[model samples]
Target: MRQVIVLGAGLAGSFLACRLLRQGCHVTLIDDRAPMSASRVAAGLYNVITGRFGSKTWKAETLLAELDAVLKDPFFQGVSQFIHPIHIYRPFKDVEEYNQWSGWSAEPAYHQLVKFEERPLFPEVIHNPLGGIRILPCGWVNIGGLIDRLQDIFRSNGGVVLQGSIPYDQINMGQKTLTWKGEPLGFDQMICCEGYRIRQNPWFEKLPVQPNKGEILEIESEGLDQLPFVITKKVYMVPGESGRWIVGSTYEHLFDDPGPTEAGRAQIEEQLRLVLKVPYKVVGHRAGIRPTTPNRRPILGSHPQWPFLYTLSGFGTKGMLAAPYCSRLMTAHILEGAEVPEELRITQFKAFRPT
Candidate 1:
């Protein structure tokens, strides 16, 4: 069996480790287990139609199908506790936007993904004067919970789990070896899925992965507890347990700190006021940096200089929906020498190639 060391235990790493194990590889998964890591703070939302224009996600059907299949697989059977299926309601800003959605809803491409409603679903609580479109196959996956479960499954399957970060200097690319704090590790290959921390990696640092910081808020609002589905306008509001609701997400390409900031909170509250009329109390706030690429596509494939080294990152805000399918592809690439799609291959970036 191929001996592999998968770095970072976030969604990407956890999924890849499990996939590698299933492919009959001996795997050791390492992580720093940072509290505010992106996967831990992610809303784990999977929406086929997203963005301000409501465009279809790239490979939405295939991604969603793989996600569903993985969730239902026997290996991840008990993860249903983290799976919450609900549609997303995007309130129309005006008559023109409503007309646009109405036309798009009947189009062949959107008919299966969205439906336009002429009448407001909740006028008292929402500011949808022009009605909205309900996006199907949309929901949140409790990513933190899913990762915990996957790690447990990995451990139960004889995969080793290591806690702590590996320093860059300890990696010997020339020798294709890794030593954690002076202790040498045995592995045939190393795959880095370090999320935003990828910027610190020497081998993959030049791949154009920008650290995009995002902040979110957890609020308690009895008025919103009855929300049957997620609501989105300037920001998204996902109903949680009891009277709690998950709101927010402010995207900041430039920031001074990685922790939650007052400015970020204000930005989220301002957007929240635009669509939600309910009163809420902020109970939790978090911040995490996502590894976003310029093209918004994930970066995957082997390192140009070191054939035994690889990276799987840049899933950005769509990591939850993309991880399952991407992990499978990475597994195949490593084990069967399958080629990664051209758009996602790190080779597309000249800097990622050998000098």
Candidate 2:
């Protein structure tokens, strides 16, 4: 069996570890239990349609299809209490946006993803005066809960262990060998799924990782109790159980702290006002850093200088939807020598490598 050490127990790490475990690898999953990870604060939303222009997301069909299959698999079913699939409703901002959506909704590519012929006008509970489009195969994942369940499952199988993060300097990745703490470690590979912390990873600091801090607010609003689908306008308002909605998020590229900021809260609140027609009380606030890349593709593959050292991070805002598909690809690449898609390959960025 291949021995593997997967770093960071967030979305990407958890998915990669699970895949490696299934491949019969002896895995040790490490995490520092930091709140700085994107998985922790991520809304865990999976949307096939995104952006102001309503363009298709990267590999949405493949990723969403895989997500549907995996979420139904017996193994995933047992550990996926944190997952729930719901449709999404994107409110048309005006006549221009409405015409655009109406035009696109009829196209062969988008017709299948929609639930309605024309844009549906929601009830007065929501402020969708210009109507909205319903996007199917959308959902949210409770990542923290998913991580805990994954750890339990991994531990129960006796093939995986969860431990504190390892010191960076302790790992010496040679072509044919890996040593930890000045001792030989019998692992075929070490995959780094270090999330936002990837920017600080000594082996991959030059890979063009930009950590963006995001904030969200959970609010209690009885008026929106009937909202079964996620509502997106200025900001997304995801319906939660018991008359609650998760409203967020503000993206700040150059933040000094990962914690929620007043400015971020204000920004989210302003967007919330624009979308939500109901009065709501803020019940909670959260913030975390997202591991975004310049081209907004996943940063994956092995280090050029050390083949044993692999990276499986930089899923960014789409971690919930992208991690599973990317993890499968990464596992196949490591075990079966499958090809890593060029967009996600780490070597695409021709930057400096530490000697």
Q: Evaluated with lDDT, which candidate comes out highest? A: 1
lDDT of 1: 0.88
lDDT of 2 by residue, 164-273 (tens): 65677666565444445466566778888888788778987777778888899999977887777898887998876445678888888887877987888899988878
- Model 1: lowest-lDDT 10 consecutive positions: 239-248
Output the number of the TM-score-best candidate: 1
Give residue 46's error in model 2 in angstroms. 0.5
In candidate 2, clashing pairs total 0
Q: Please report how far candidate 1 places residue 201 from its true position, in Å.
A: 0.9
lDDT of each: 0.88, 0.80
What lDDT score is found at residue 260 in candidate 1?
94
Which TM-score value belongs to model 2? 0.94
Candidate 1 Cα misplacement greater than 4 A, ranges = none
Q: Write the per-residue lDDT of candidate 1 for residues 34-87, one digit (tens) a residue.
A: 987899888778899888788899999999899889877998777778878899
